[model samples]
Target: MSAETNKALVRRFFEEVLNGRNLEVIDELVATDYQEHDPFPGQREGREGLKDRMTMLIEGLAPTFTIDDLIAEGDRVVIRWTNNATHSGTFLGIPPTGRSCRFAGIDIFRMDDDRLAEHWHVVDQLSMLQQLELLPSS
Candidate 1:
């Protein structure tokens, strides 16, 4: 697939699947053997695992995502993004703080035949935790 096409595929995963609450699209956008290079604590594995993770975040954070930047080359797409959300539901053993939070992250996705085959990401968890008053700010 072309670089633009690869970027589009990854964008859909964020725009549609995560932000839009269209979790079903995961099957369409992700490979069945999908691999998350950095899985969260206690997260499962494979396509189903990815779907489960998305569901958890969407429910927990009720986040609205914005794609800040998208760059693609070969089969890899790198996306810089931010999300603003409310802690309306539990996430990662942290109960809902009813606190609003904003955070940013960068994710790199590897495309295989137009589907996302692998993913790696770095999210500003410290900022989010501190904003929620779950951790002391330095």
Candidate 2:
């Protein structure tokens, strides 16, 4: 796909799937036998399965987080921003602290035939833990 086309695909994915909270978009953006290589949760198959996992992630930190600085290159997009939210739910075995926290990260996605084929992403998990009081605030 052209760079602009790829960028549009990503924009739709983020806008409709992620930000819009529309799981159905996954089917349109992913293959039926999509392969997910998310290290945080092992592996999953099918677009619906991926949507389920994403739903968990979003619901776990909803109304407090949004994707920012989403830029695309070729078939990949690099997102740079902070996930700021109040810890009102459990995460990674950490209880709610009601503490607001911010952590920045970059996610690179690879597209295949206009659909999201794979992803390689990294986030500031340590900073999030610290903000949640699970780790030293220093």
Determine the backbone clash count of candidate 2. 0
- Tens digits of per-residue lDDT, candidate 1, 75-102, equal 9999999999899999988899999989
- Candidate 2, residues 59-137, lDDT tens digits: the string is 6555244567777777777666567666766544456777777887777778888788877778898898787778897
Worst 10 residues of 2 by lDDT: 35-44
Candidate 1 has an lDDT of 0.91
Q: What is the lDDT of residue 26 in candidate 2?
A: 88
Q: Report the error of model 2 at residue 60, Å.
A: 1.2
lDDT of 2: 0.71
Candidate that would win on lDDT: 1
Each candidate's number of clashing pairs is: 0, 0
